[model samples]
Every structure is written in C-alpha cells, then in structure tokens.
Target: MQLSGLAPGDWVTVQARFTPQAAFLVAADGRTRTYAEGEQRITRLARALRQLGIGRGDRVALLAVDSPEYVEVLLACMKLGATYVALNFRLSPAEIRTVLAASGAQVIFHSARYQEIVDGCRLRDAIQFESGYEEFLAGGPDGGELPAVTNDDDILSISFTSGTTGTPKGVLQSQRMIKAITQSGVLELGLRPGDLIYSGAPLFHAAGFGHVLYGVARGGASVIMPQWDADLALSWLGSGRVRHATLVPSMIIQLLEHPELAEADFSGLRSIMYGGAPMPTSVVRRMADVFGCDLHNGFGAGTEAGGQLVLRPEDHRRALAGDEWLLGTIGRPAFGCDVRLLDPDGAEVPDGAVGVIASRGDTVMSGYLDRPDLTARAVRDGWFVAGDLAWKDQEGFLHLAGRADEMIIRGGENVYPVEIEDVLGGHAAVAEIAVVGEPDPHWGQVVTAVVALRDGHGTPSAAEVKEHCRGRLASYKVPQRIVVVANFPRNPAGKIDKLRLRELLAEGRIS
Candidate 1:
C-alpha cells in the first residue's frame, strides 16, 4: 500500500502490468486510452525527448490545451527525471515568452492551435503536436530502458505563480512533494479503485493535475474536459459512470443554472470536491440536496503548497443542521500537514486573531526556480508563508478574512492587479490606474479598474478601456468596470491609498 518509493511514472508502469486493460483516461472527444496504452505512449515519448538532448534535470515546457498528449508529456518527463514546466494557455504571447526564458526550457511542446503564438515567441527547438509530434516519436526507439530516478528532491515540475503582485516565480515541486499530495488526496478525499473521476480544470493548474495523479495512484479512471461546460458536465454526470468530480464554485453555480439540470441524473456521483475560492453557504446546501452527494471543500495556496485544509462530509452535515458558523470555515488542517497563523515576526498569533497563514510539510515545494531571494522570503525555517489572512476559531476551524496581497480571484482564476495595472499604465488617456476585485453573484469577483485620466485627455468609456486591454492581457484579466476619478487619495508616504479606494468603491462614492 506504500507509494513512497515509486514516482508517478513508476506507478503507471506497475498499473499497466497488473491492469493493462483498465481504462486510464477518457477525453471529452470520447477517445480512450487504457493503462497499458498510456504507458507505452509515455515510454515512446521519453525516448524521443532523450534523443532531443533532454535528460535529468533539464526543463521541458508544455503549452497546450487539455488532452491525453498533455498527460503523456508529463509522465514522460517524470520517467526521464526532467523538470516539467506547465504553461498556461490563457497567457498572452509576451507572458509566454517571459515564462519560457525564466524556466530556461530548451524545448517546448505545443498544440497546433497555438502554433502561431509559439512561432511568434521564437522559441528554440519547438515541437508542434499537429505536425511534429508523431514524427518526433518515430525518430526514437520505443520501450527502452530509462535512467533511474532515485532522488526524492529531484525537481519533478515547476509550476509558476499567478504573478498577481509581480513576476511569476516558478515553484519547484519534487517527487516527494507530489507523492505526499497524492497520498493525502487519496486518504482525505476517499478515492477508491474503479472510481470514475471527472475534471474540467486546466492541467496547467495544480488542482487539475493533482486530481489526475490521484486517479492514477488509486487505479481509477479519469474523464477530462478541454474546458468547462455545464451542459457537457451534466451529460457526463447523467451517464452514471462518474463517481467523483473536482470543480470550482463558479462551475457549480453554472451547473445549477443549466436548464437540463432539472432532468439530469446524479445518482452515481459519490462526492464533489470544490476549492480555489470560497463557496457560498446557500450554494453548498442546494448542491448537496440536489445531488445527495458528499461535499468536500478544500483550501490551500497555489502549486507551492498542496491542499492544507479540507472541510469533511461530517462538517457539512453539522453546518446544514444549524451550526451555520462552520459554513465559513475551511475545516481543520489536513492529515500529515501543519498550518499556523503567525504574526509579522513569525510568532504564533492568538486564536481568533487575524494573521498570516503559514504551512510546512512534505507537500510543500522545494523552492522557487533560480530565485533564492524569493524562496527565502517565502519560506522561513521550513514553513511557507501563504500570504493569506485568516483567523482560527476556538474549535480550530480556519476562517479566511481576506488576502494580504491585492490578488483577485475571478471564477477561480488568479488575476493580479499589478499585471493589469502595468498593461493599462501604457494607455494614452490613462494617467494613473489601480485594479481591485468587486463582488459578483456568479463569478466570486470581477476585476474593476479605477483610473485617473490625464488633465488634457478626454475620459474613456469602460468598454473603450477594456477594449484596449483585450489583446494585451487574458480575457479574465480585463477590467469589467472602469471608474474614472480626478485624483486618488494618498497615504503619508505619498503612495496611492488602495485601501481608501476600496472604501470609496464599497460606499458607492467611486463609479
């Protein structure tokens, strides 16, 4: 039962040998791959990558939509001991370039749809999936002996931060870290053999890949969607094959809003795992009632630290019966994980006092890639400072107060104000700009930009400002509301007072 000594690829090899005919992956397009078939493809890919001069410790960047090829590349990297760099497809060309340069990725594998963007990036040794992938695999021998991956600390993947505050730092995750997360997920989420897990989140994100890894380790089948669609998800649920699903709160809301939901059958779904943002109590109640499935809510920082806290099924029942206070809490620290609320001086804070949430465990990332200074600042001693504000109640449940940084969570996507501010600062009519999140019913929050126009320039409409950002940033990062002001309030140090701006927005004084 121990999964410690084996890496993810090792597990895949074992599963292929023992249960070769079992379905391992089913794509939205209805293409299916068994455990043995997946291992064979990964073996071929590992050999191809080795022939291209990629070996242990080398970084391989993958920029593509969700597909079986994506998982193949990931496992291939794991088998070869090369670092996997998962690039977000939503990023603009400029953003993609920055990540490629920072990761020192010598080779990139991209989907055909993004070939134009990849060409624009001028990446060295790029392999396009449409035309180059099959030929690339043909160039190398298949089912060859590979190098041994014995070191637990060898970097397995480098997941970049959301870059909300500044440049996205690469979080270096090791085999040990991923193993810890897989074990924790299996135990905490009750993953079992033969379970059919469904996931719509992009594999570039930790939550998405982590779910797949969990299914692989448990010898279960996984159904992956290229993108989130309520109608497709409903159909999958009604098929009576899906037993578990990982989703964000926004997706749950959309599924409930779908007209077909009234007739959909959810009898096969045993559990629904949600996270990445807070879930409204009302929504949580309605989902449980409609599906009659256990609801598990998890909270954690990005890829750096895997899941830290998870609200169990029993907690949901208690909250539904009138202990409503538990609805806002993120339950207790997960098994094998340690969490603490520390003051600025790194001292533990008293219960019920807001403080920075820090965690340390086997699941924590090794460090930031090539950035020792940032690694030191983020990890003190052994704990990683989450940069999230929260307070623990008397019963030890953690209640999130707010973010210590100005990162916006728009429909589970992390949108940094600084990235948006940098893009808008170049506008001809914009004198000064600040971005913040405004509460929304469907999406947890919407990006709102408050701008101060130059004296001689004419005021720009909200649509005009958003149109200017359309090409420069991702669609989710574009400001939904643009508020023009003559001047911004400043603190004593002459810095723009963002706190004051938020207050004005809340009071309806700024629009």
Candidate 2:
C-alpha cells in the first residue's frame, strides 16, 4: 500500500503485475491504455531512448500537448534513469530553443503540430510524435529488461517556473518529491483503485501533470483533456464517466456560464479538486448547488515545491452555510507538509500578522537546476520560501496577502492586491479582477485595478468600482484607478499575466 520507496516507473510496474487489466490512461481522443499495455509501451520507449544514446542522468525533452505519449515519455525516462524535461508548447521557438539549451537536452520529442518549431532548433535528435513515435517504439522490443533507477534523490524531471515574475528557472523534481506529492494527492483527494480522474491541466505543469501520475500511483485511470473546453468537459462529467475531476477557477466559471449547464448531470462525481487561483464566493456557491460534491481548494507551492495546503470539502460546506470567511483562506497545511508564516527575520509571525509563507517537506524540489546560488536563497535550512506572503488566523487557517514582489507600496503603505481584488471582485459587474501599482511621483506607486465585467452586465465606472471597495477595504487599499478590459492576457498556465499588464501599462497600451 505504501508508495514512498518506489520509483516512478515502479508505480506502473506494480500495477501491471497486480492489475494488468485495469485502465491506466484514457486520452482525450478516446484512446485507452491498460496497465499491461502501458508497461510494455514504456519499456519499448525506454529502449528507443537508449538507442538514441540516452542513459542515466541524460536529459530528454518533450514538447507536446496532453496525450498518452506524454506519460509514456516521462515513465520511460524514469525507467532509463534519465531526466525528463517537459517543454511548454506555448513558448515560441526562440524560447523553446533557449530552454532546451539550458537543460542540455540530448533529444527532443515533439508532436507533428510543432514539427517546424523542432526542425528549426539545433538538437542532437528530434522525434515527431505523429510520424516518428511509432517508428521510435520499434527501435526497442515490446517488453524487455530496463535500466533500474536506484537513487530516490536522483532527478527524475525538471519543471520550469512560469516566467510571470521573470525568466523561468528549472526546478529539479526528484523521485522523492514526485512520490511525496503523489502520495499526498492520493490521500487528500481520496483517490481509489480503478477510479476515473479527469483534469484539464496541461501535462507540462507540475501541478497539472501530477494528476496524470496520480492515476498511476493509485492504480486508476486519468481522463486526459488535450485542451480546456467547457462544453466537452460538461458532457464528460454529465455522462457519469469520471469519478473525480481537477479544474481551475476559470474553468469552473466557464462551466457555470455554459448554456447547457442546467442539463448537465454531476451527481456521478465523488469530488472536485480545484486550485491554481482563488474562486469567487458566488461561483463556489453556484458550483456547489450544481455539482453537489466535495470542493477541495488546493493552494500554495510553486514549481520549486509541491502542494502546501488544501481547503478541504468540510471547510467549503461550513463556508457555504455560515462561516463565509473560511472561503477566503487557503485552509490548513496539507498532509506531510510543514507550513510556516515567517517574518523578515525568519521567525514565525503572530496570528493575523502578515509574513512570508515557508514550507518544509518531502514534496519540495531538490533544487533549481544549475543555480546553486538561487537555490540556496530559495531553500534555507530545508524550508522553501518563494516570497508568497500570507498570515495565519487564530483558527490556524492561512490567508493569502500577495507575493512579496507583487505587493504594492503606495504612499509608504504596503498594499496586498489579493485583499483589494477579493473586495472589488464581489461587485455585481466584476467577473475578473487584478490589482497592480502604477508609478506615481506623488505616492511612489498608485494602486490601479484592471477588471473584466460579467456578461449581460453594464460597465461599472471607475468611480463606481472604487466606491465598491471604499467601505470594504481600508482607505489606502482602495484602487486609485480602475480600468475595464474586455479580457486580460494570461500565461500558459491560465493565470492573469500581471507582468505583461505592467509592460502594457508602461508602454501606454493598457491605459
């Protein structure tokens, strides 16, 4: 029952031996892979990788969308003891080349859609998933002896940080981090053998990709979606095909806004795990009314760390009933994660006092790839601090303030954008909201709010938006200016690109 000592490949091997007929993967296109087929395919892929001069500690990169092949490549790398790097398909060719070079990838596997992009790059080897993948599988036998992965501390993969704040850095994901994260997810989400879990998150993201591996760890099938489509997702959930699902807040909102939402049957769902952004109370309540299943709000941990906290289903029930404030919190520390809120001096902060969120656990990554100095700064005394700021209330729930870098300073007073966004987002007209500080000679930085209005709602004037936050927040915390946009630019992971917004503001493009 314990999965702590197993390598990533061992997770598959165990299931193949014990439950060979169980479904391991259900792709978006209706392709299915049983545990036996998965083990054989992975073994063949590992052999193919070996033929390409890949070995232990070697780097192999994959640039593609979500597919059964993505999981195969990762597990093959694990079996070969090579390091896997999942390149973001959204990145431009120039950026992709840069990341490949940084990772020292010996070979690159990409889908046919990205053939031109991969062809333009200078790599030792490139295999197209559409044309070359089957041929590549033929390079090795269907099933054979594979290299053993000996060390738990060995790097299994490298996940890049979403470069919203700055340039992306490779976060080393070791076997230990992967196992710990998968175990935590299995326990917290109540995953069971043969369960059909669905997730819309891409395979490249650490958090999103974990769902794929979670299916393997728990002897279940992961229903993979190539892209986020609200209607398609509703149909799948309505048909009673998926027992558990993972989604973000935006995806949830989209499902709620769908024209056929009322017709969708979600009674088959056992639980819904949501994270990557905060959800509005309206959306949460509405979703609860529709789905009527457990809503788990997973929070914290960047690419450098795994999950830190989880606002469980019980908390959501309580918040929906009477204790509404619990909806604003990110719940308590997750299983096996030691979360702490520390001051500038690395001391724990008093209750209700804002401090940097720090965590120490097996889920934390080994280190940033080839950036020991940055790694040393990020991981101090075994705790990973990523500049996320939060405060623990008297009841032990943690409330997010904002990132240390994203905190707005106006007139020498510190302002957290989350507080302002939470207040203004409750407005009848606001569908999405982001707060940023615009440069002001008078106040050092002026608080600015950018928002998208709800469909079928009239535009709220800047004055009206400001007034909405006036009584809910402190005087200084209220937005000095409000700008309404049709939609905000988002990063690959679907987070509002504040860094991009700041750039547009500086160029006078967003005014």
Candidate 3:
C-alpha cells in the first residue's frame, strides 16, 4: 500500500506493470506514440510541470483533446503528486472556467488551436505544446539539476463529475484508484494484452483516464480519436483487425447511422464496453446490428469507488432476446464490487424498490477532492452512495431508473423523467434528448424535454411530439413542454447540460 510521504513530482516511480515498448497510442496527427515514447514524454513533462510551480496536491488543469499529450500530462502530474484536472476542449471557455474554478487548478495547458483562448485566461502560466513545452522543461524546476523520483499522496487526479442533478463535484482518484479500476475492468471487461482499444470519449473524464491505465496495465494499443467523429470511427472499425473500444450511447447512434457501416466490418472487435450516459433502448438494438462484436454495457461513474456494474455481452444479448426490459438495465455489479440499493435513511430497500444506488469495493474513489462534507454525504457506513436511483430484480439485474433528484414529483406522483424520455428517445427524429423538471403551478413541477433534432431532419412540432409521447406515456409523465433546438449544451463529458437547461427553461426561453 502507498502510505504517506509519497511525492508525485520529484523522486516519483511508476513502474507500470505494462511495458513501454507497446504501441500505447495513435495520436490525432497520425503519429504512433509508443509506451516508451509516452514514458519519455511524461518524464520531460514532469520537468515542465515542476517548472510551472506545480507541487504535490496542487491542481493543474489539462485542457486538451484525446491526444498523446493528454496522457503525457496525466503521467507528469501523477509523478509530481499534483492533482490534474482534465477539461473538455469542447466546452465553452465559461464552462471550462466553471471546472477550473471548481478544481482550483493552479496551472493550465492547451493545444496550439486553443492558444488564443488560454492566452486570454488569468492563469499563472498557460503553456503550449512542443517548442513552448520543451523550453519550459529546459528551465530548471525548484528541484534544480536532474529530475529526482519521489512519492507523496498519490492523489494524482481530481476528476470532475457533473452528476445529473447537481453542480459538478471533483471525484478524487489516487494513482491506486486508477490502477484498481483498470485491473478489474481489464479482467471483467476482458481487455487483453496486445488488444487494440478504440477510445472516443474526451480525455477529461474518468472513463478516459481508465483507458490510459488499462492500456498501460496490459501493454495494449490505444486507437485515439482526438474528437469523437462517427465517420472516422467507422473507418477505423472497417479496417478489420482484433480490437476493443469504449463509447457512450450517442456515439453508437452515429456509427449506426453511417452509410458505410452496414457493409463495414465489426468482426475485428473482440470486446466493446460502454457506460457514461444512459443507453437508449433503440440504440442498444442498433448496436447489435452494426457492431457484431462482444458488446457490453458498463454502468459506472467517478464516484462510489469508480467502476460499479457490467452487463456482460452474452448476458446483454441473452437478456435482450429473452426480455427487452434488460435493454434499459445497467446490468449487475462488476467483479469484486459490492452493490446495493439504499433509501435516504441509509437502509437497504427491497429488491424491486428504487433507491439511491450504493457500492463498496476496491474500485471506489478516495473521496471528493478537498471537500469533507461532500465526501461524508457520498460515503456512509462504508458504502459509497451514488445519487442515482435504481432497482434490482429478483434475479439480481440492476435497472438504473435515473438520478434521485431527477425523479419528478408531479401532482404528488413520483416519476422518473428518464422513463418518459427513454420512451421518446426511440423516435427517429430525436438525435439528442434531455428531460428536466420545469415550473408548473398545478403539478408543482412538470417534466420537460429539450431535444436536438437529427441533421437535415425536420423537427416535429411540440404538439406532435407530445401526441407521440401521449400514445406511449401516461398523461402525467408526458413532457409538459418541448424545446426544439440546434444543439443541447453539454458538459466536458458530453452528458446533457440539464443544469443550464433548467436555467433556459426558467427564463421563458422555451415553452
């Protein structure tokens, strides 16, 4: 076990169980950066971070896409015992500020494309790539002379989680937590050495970091798309070879929509894991059709000790064939993770009742970064409570209804907004959909859906959409209003921005 006195920057040692010769990454520039290259870059970057006054427990924001440099910064920060916050490059500068302010990051790094953006920031230092980075490293850090290895509080990262219902919270993950999640994920998810893992999520989230650790832990190859592009993703998948990948449901939808997809090859995919947002039932069907690989649904977050559940491919297929209900379920807990449902009173609820889902296991996070009250509320009685409400059937399969706060109280009836949203998400025109509670005089608060239509698709009027839902959902559950727009605002992790969605609705921006 890593005890105290473990410094991250100087005299730090991360003897990766996976070797450095392995092809670690395929960068956006089409350059293949191997594990050895990653290691060398990390060592150099450590020098750079230290030069910028980063120290153990200090927060540094890495705002970039899924490039080799992203992983390099992660390595440098971990080596220094500094906390690195991975910010989504897709976020607006204001949203980025929200995460940066929340993380208390002392240093910020950006790509050449975002130089102007970073230059405008009030950061102590906004470093760029290559020449700038090399010059920074050339300058001696506080340590002086050659780099020294040390260990401290392996608090390597403070990954922010924008829970579906509340303001974002930084989930504290140690070097050990990253190692633990990858170990279990590799084993349970069947990530093998020599396997090629296609990663599409923004490098800012825990799932993204998990891919890095998984690659390093197993000496695997990572096929990175700096940005999630469905066409490029299909091309990669079509160039058939043994591979694995992780994705969100939306990415899957785009892949299925690709004209070249049906003829493309999926035989190369050995394993595929997805779980960040809810998996729309219709999208799950499309997954079976387009990606004939061993696909599974993994339900997890940066909280509750990290990785919590896995719906194995065989189980997913079997369940789907036998009972369509499994389509919405996040499946059972992953190997070695203990999961259960708990009421607000901290008591276990019956199998069929929905309550806050809780987990206890090695894969759990250390705690919220520097927030004791928040930490205590999340972890109670040895169980790390995820604010999501879910229920398990008699067979032990878990169905994630939605977040506890996301549950709408309409005219005294408790309704999970996801249930109605899920029903409507199946429509052909609904490309992206987020359901939120809006002000309602009679019902106190009514369910509202802010939708983004598919490209070139004419958006259905609010009345028509409501009628469609009326056919499928109860009157109480139908969306009280619908806002058709070009795009729904998203957080770094690409989850719907309901917090801002609520703000827009409150301002009478949408009926």
Candidate 4:
C-alpha cells in the first residue's frame, strides 16, 4: 500500500461511501458550513492553486488560526491529493521558515496578521488568507470532479512534534494509519451525532486536528477554539451544546479556577479527555466532583504517527472505583499501536519493572524528514521507541517513569522528575510546574523545579516547596533548586519549554 503517486486527480478516481451529512466545520458563532458547499469551494481553490502552479502531490501549507476556511483548504487539498501542511502559528517566523523550507512548500496561504512574517520569509510566492481565500475559491476551475485517487497508504501530512529539546521532527501521517486511530479515539470519547466537543488545543498539533477526525468518524460535531482561552472556553462549555472536551492538565487548572466553573452547566457533558501530560491527582479529584462529568485522563507519546495509548473512559471509571493506582498508570496499548516495554538490551521486562515505552504501527512515520540517523535509532525492530521511560503492571496499565533523556542519574541511581513534579503540583499556590536536570558538580545532574504560580499568590521559595515534596516523594527526589516565573515558554502544543529553562539556569536566575 506504499504510495508513489498521490495527487487529487488520482484520488477522485476511487469510489467509496461518501457521507453527505458531512458538516465540514461549525464556527464558534454557530455557523454550519456544509460538505457540499465546502467541496465547491475546494474545487475553486484547487483551480486557483493550479493557476498558481500548485499541482497534484504538491504541498499547500497553512499558517493561520483555525476557521472554516482552514478546513476548506484542507479538504480541497485532499480532493487533489495535495498534502495540506498546517504550520504552527506559535513558532517564530524564523522557526516557521525551518518548517516551510524543510517541507518544500511552493505556496503558503497565511493570515494578514502575519504580513510582516510573510514578507520576512521572502518566499517566492504566497497568498493572504482573507483576501485570497474567497478569490481562490471563486476563480479556480468551474470544474467537474478533480482527482482523489489517493489510497490507504497515501501520505496525508507532515506533522511536527513540539519537542522539549526544540528540535522538532516532522512525523508523516497516512490515510490508513489515521483511519484506525480516529475510529477508536471517537469511540473512547463516546461522541454521538451533533455532540458539541470544544477543542481549544492547537489544531496544528495532533490533538487539535486529530480530534477533528475523531469527531467526524463518530458523526459528531467538533468546535475548534483557535487557541486556548479560559473565559471563551468556559462560555462554550456553559453554552449547553458542548457535551465533551479534551484538555491538557494546565488548561484543566485554569478552567477549574475560573469563577464561572462553580455555576457552569456541565450537565450536558458525559465525558472529558485529558492528556499532553499527567494532571495532578488533586485537580483530577476536584474536576470529577465539580464538573460532575466522567474524567478520562491517559498518557501517550504523540508524534506525526499518531497517539500511542489512551486511558478510555470506562477504564478510568473502573480504576476510579477501586484501582486508584490507575490514576498514575498510562493504560494499555491502543488499538492502532504495537507497544513494548523494553530494557536497555531491548528485551521485554516483567510487569512492574521499568523500561522504555515503544510502539510500532502503520501510523509510525516512514522517517523524520531528513533525519534518517535519528529515525534509525528511534525505529528499531520496527518500533518507534518514544524515548519515554515507563513500565507495565500485571493488569497491563502502563506507568510512566519519565523521559529517558530527562532522567536524573544521581550517584548512579535514576530518579524520575515527574514524581517530584506531581508532589509540587499539589500545592495550592502552584499553578503549573516542570522539573528539569540542572548541572551539578557533585551529583552530575540535580533536579530543578521551574514553577508558574497561581495569580495573586506570592511565589514559593525553593526551600518552601522542598518541604512540601518531602512527605510525598523520596528524599532524593525533592527538587534541589526552584525557579519562579510568570509563565514557561511553550511549544505549539502547550508543553513547557525545558530547553529555555536550561538557559534560565545557565544565567544563574534559578540554580
């Protein structure tokens, strides 16, 4: 099924069950954009693209906030077998240049807000989103069916990971690969037709766009938030239509703290999904009680290939009943991925023994764009070793230890930073926190906690937080250094930037 020729003209030749009820997108303002209207727009866009020399198999990169237009362009590209590349708006123009250059995109459709950026990139050609969007749609070929001969193995996208190391890798997505993950994820979310699932997460990231597919697969409605906004998100949740949501732990903290949270009508909500990292157990308990909705939190290594594990709602409910330990476990291998817990020798370890979490599936990328050596190291024995350290229990739920690279080797004893972080995160004054390895002349690498505190609260000193962790974590696991900041630098997906944290340490600001 490996595709060599993927162009819109080709995919249109294939006949499959086309769902006419496909609602392309529903805006936050309650506008229903239909698939038929969207398809017409796509044809014009394809025609306009063709005029601009954007051909089959070409890359049409999008660098803008989420909207109905973004989805239209994506559908148009799909019609032509053109791979739609969604660029992260959070990245600096220079960082974006790296992606566009690496992607070899000929035409980039962007927002006017980024006019200066488009000018800075000095791209050979470009189109403004607001101005060109409608023009491209209305002017492209008054065409008959274009092409959509793409197959199951056709490459769909080149999604980049928001790495803590700052070296993002483009993980390729395939048609068949995502089909399986989306179906399963939709089921896990318990979405039904017309179920309003508000996704404020970045669409450029897997959680953002992938969730859209999950919603569509289940015949549900997905409401994109463009970016995270606590007040706006709460408005949607209280709007009575929104019945489901997926969030990162940090967002959960903000939502629960919002004043409206106390009175917000969450009666419509049946399930809530959380990931991108573990939420503090304290927050989880409060969410369960306050929202009166089932909390389904799980862990996964997200790459272009897709999600590796899911803590399904049923499993979470079962664990909440008695297996409280499952709160710390990442759950079992997902349907789409072949997971493994391997020791240094790449051999399987017994249940409860720590090892590296790895996965293999068609969803796994062919390779990181232009990083074959790195890809080789990652995809050994046909598995993408996610570089996350974890273990499986006898019941098969996975317990995340930490990032293998981030592990602090103290006097030869490895310590996980997550354990210390979970302890510090429980404090009332703390809003969000990340632990990173800092240079130490004695221990080789000492653990440091970089914290962002709750508003109107005084910052906790290093010693103050160490005392808090002392009771819950091992003595060696307590942070030796604490750095206070208003906010941590985040990638598009909202994961804190540890590389920037290292710079803060080198400047003697924290350590």
Best by TM-score: 2
Model 2 lDDT per residue over 1-511, tens place: 5886667777888888899999998876668889999888898888888878889999999999878887889889998889999988888788888888899887988888888888877789988888888888988865554546647889988888878888889999888888888889999999889989888778898766798788888899987777777877998888777889988777887888889988888878999988776577777888899998999998867467888999999999999999998988888999889999999999999998999999999999899889999999999999999998999988899999989998999999999998888777788887888899999999999888888878988777867866776768888888878787887888777778898998888898877
lDDT of 4 by residue, 23-129 (tens): 64678777876555555666677777777776656787888888777766776666656777888888878888887788877778888888887777656678787
Residue 465, model 4, lDDT: 72
Ranking by lDDT: 2, 1, 4, 3
Evaluated at residue 452, the lDDT of candidate 4 is: 81
Per-residue lDDT value at 480 in model 1: 81
TM-score of every prediction relative to native: 0.80, 0.97, 0.85, 0.90
Model 2 ranges with Cα > 4 A deviation:
144-147
Whole-model lDDT values for every prediction: 0.82, 0.85, 0.72, 0.72
- The candidate that wins on lDDT is 2
TM-score of 1: 0.80
| Comparing 1 and 2 on TM-score, the stronger one | 2
